[model samples]
Target: MMRRKSWQKNLKIAVAALLIIYAVEHILTMNVYLRKPMLFSPLFRVYNQSGSEPHCPSVRLSTRVLPQIALASYPGSGNTWVRHLLQQMTGIATGSIYNDEQLRHNGFPGESLSNGSVVAVKTHNHYAGKDYARAILLIRNPYESMLSLFKLANSNHTGEPSVDRYGKQWGTFTEERIRGYIPLFASWIKLQDVLPIFYDALKQNLTRELVRIKAFLGQSGIKGDVRCALRDSEGHFHRKETGITLEFFYSKKQRMAVNSVIDQMQKMFKDRFENIREDMDTWKL
Candidate 1:
């Protein structure tokens, strides 16, 4: 009789503790539902207020369809940043063919290479799903882009910089990245299947570039709230302040090195180079 009483007391205590936890969690969830109404209200309504089917799922109608355009960029050219902007502005996610673990850690959604509902897909690979109408090629001057990439390779080395066929070392890694991409850029530009977007434009005037991105993606209704985008992106870990700047990255030696590489590519891809002829110097850099 004494043991039975003790067991009953312990069971009651456990039940009370569980009830307290459930109540606290309910309150917190309600707070979130109130604060972020756009994100949570609809789902909450479906689950809480639906008559017979309290567990009915919220139906989401996609605003855009995919097999969509690629937001293509070489590494360190702010590819992940632009993808975040799109995700925030539209609530549609960005994807990559490679499904890099690094990209996901930065808040990208799951692997979405074939997800047609995705708004924009990131790709560094040349020939992945070329049937997309056009690509938003995010270009940063190689001086900054390569330098940023080199710094990344050193601090948190990934296979990104070492993927060259010839096994180029860090001294020549930047040059090889530029040389390899010049021909690819020329070909894509010549085919007119790419809209070249300079990374500087996005940084300097976010709203203007946001408008361009919306126009390119054919979704101008969402306003592309630049202030909101900036606020939201401020907390992401991958976006740590790097102290890298355009003026800092710009150097005569870097310019001359890239120019030599571009010159070599230009000889072989003459007609193709004509596509972005005006921006070639910046591209050369």
Candidate 2:
């Protein structure tokens, strides 16, 4: 009888513990799903939202106004926005390797065709086209870029991931992307006549960056206005701002490893572009 009672008592305790655990878990889940904001909320209001400027006319290149220039950037590095700005400034449609149906219907009629039909083609691959002679390489902070990639992967271009998805995937996804940056930068650096544009700097000064791009493209006779492009700088691709916290998501060891790689890249850029003092500032957080 004593042994039986003891076993029964233990069973009772186990059941009570499980019930408590279930209750706590349910409450936490409710708090997350019902009360808390998303983990991947927009962390900064970097772009302007107002602009009634007529949609920039998208036209096919008749005589190859610019050389075979690739507008190169990693996924989620604001390539679409840059393309929009380029169209606004140059009045010529930008082409891309992947023909996104949404982009095609929305504004990018030059989607999927990287020939002379477009001024500069968009490419995410390291191995750009053999015919490509020059490129405008757009670079963004790895942290921000990774977050944007995660959102794009989990949701749409401008949407946030579910809290549960973020909890399960964000850490691993971020670490992998952070590591992937090394080889991406390494390969692209080899391509000759590459102009590196920092995304943050572009956000800070839209018109200035567009002017720089205009001069780089060497198409002075284009019928697009660089100053007018600034009025609608934040095109349809920019995600809505939800918050403004730039926290480091990696652990100490991982942070050190990523920083070491970034330091090497910054040094490489310094060697490549002598006037990169402002661009070097992008390495900071």
Candidate 3:
């Protein structure tokens, strides 16, 4: 009985020892895997060919040989049209448009590209408080933007549900539906209320808007014809062959109110132009 009891005790100790060893081995393996660098393989290939590791500053400089301008605007504000025009003016290919995939690979903010001599990014997000170093804010008639948005919502080609169905499903039914047709419409409804407030602030100070843009670009030591860079003279406001038609559904008073709001926003930006220029001059590259 004593011998059998001793054997049982020894068996339990051995099992525990085996389990501890297995756990330790598993942890070490996982740790090594986690430590492996993500871009190491690509970096190694470049270094092997060049006989030196490329520095990040050099990469940034190369990407910024020409200023990297982002086309910042609200949705339905002719962003796509502006992108195409810029591509033509700069002689960059459409296939080389900066996007999130290239941005991630190049470590650029907001999935922008680095292939063009002058890189321009486009986005609709609000300015990064004061963190952005370069940006261009594009303003359009708010009424037109809303009209375009409504048409886009009503269409099926853009992979959105019909506006009539969208409105009913989401609540707040109008004779027309414009909900699922636009991306993230539910969230946008909340934003729409606040947009007029910000728009008024912006319109009241256009000069400030320009100055803020210049300051952001100046941080990269990029100084050029800022006016020409922002010009949209190519008459490429609409997509080619998309057959999208915009119809105004708002009453005259409502339309006028929208225009009035936009006008105020534009005027605000205009008033702050000098201040913006002064701010740009002070930013360090």
Candidate 4:
């Protein structure tokens, strides 16, 4: 009996060792493949529908025209509003604004096709370690953004449990579960902690910002008035107000915490506050 027990312990140790080796090998292989540039080709191909040609119009537009204009925002900081504005300005709407599944699959509809012009893609993901020629980062007060996100995620029949699906699967949109996902939603959330990082980096340099934006837009040889574009886009969301107060679903303490988060965020992105100021200054109503 003593001999049998000893043999069983040895077998378990060997099995554990084999499992560890298998896991390490699998991880190494994945790391190697992920590090390869060719891996993104399939992803780009699916977006462009052009097989293996980097110079295809769609591919060229993606790489050159826009360079990279990731409309980075929390879950609902008016991304749809921005996307619609961009679409109207570009004169290409494949009717994708209303389709969530399509947006999830194709990234964004307006820019996915070979329009041969600058494309504006909306994403909830973080910057993927690529140098973007121009990027428009739209941020909202975190409390408002988070609350809006939670509400949106919970509303749809198709939506999964927020903590379980996004939290566990991708580890995003919350602090506790950001590690497993790419771009880690938690990092974005922590943007509230150091709002100054974003403001100082992006806002203080407006001329440089405009130059980068123009450079990206010029890649498609497209030129138009951005002010006019903003007007056209803003008109779409115009609705008659019924004087209804939008109530917060969170308790007073929760609301206060969210407000605090927004206050910190505002300080960080204070430079861009002028854009909002300019809008308010010109407000006719």
lDDT of each: 0.59, 0.73, 0.41, 0.42
Q: How accurate is candidate 1 locally (lDDT)?
A: 0.59
lDDT of 4 by residue, 1-285 (tens): 999999999999999999999997897577646542112212222212354322212112233343344455656455655555445444433222134763534324454432223465556666555433334565443443454455456644123233444333222344431122223333343332111112222223332333444454555464433333323333233223334333423445444444455444444334433333222111111
Q: After superposition on all CA atoms, what RMSD does each candidate show versus the true structure?
A: 14.0, 17.6, 22.3, 22.5
Ranking, TM-score, top scorer first: 2, 1, 4, 3
* Alpha-carbon lDDT of model 4: 0.42
TM-score of 3: 0.39
Winner by TM-score: 2
The whole-model C-alpha lDDT of candidate 3 against the native structure comes to: 0.41
Model 4: colliding residue pairs: 195-268
Q: TM-score of every model?
A: 0.58, 0.73, 0.39, 0.44
Off by over 4 Å in 3: 1-68, 93-118, 153-248, 274-285
Best by lDDT: 2
Candidate 3: tens digits of C-alpha lDDT, residues 196-240: 112222334422333444454456564423233223223323433
TM-score of 4: 0.44
Clashing residue pairs in candidate 1 (N, C-alpha, C atoms within 3 angstroms) = none
Candidates 1 and 3 compared by lDDT, better number = 1
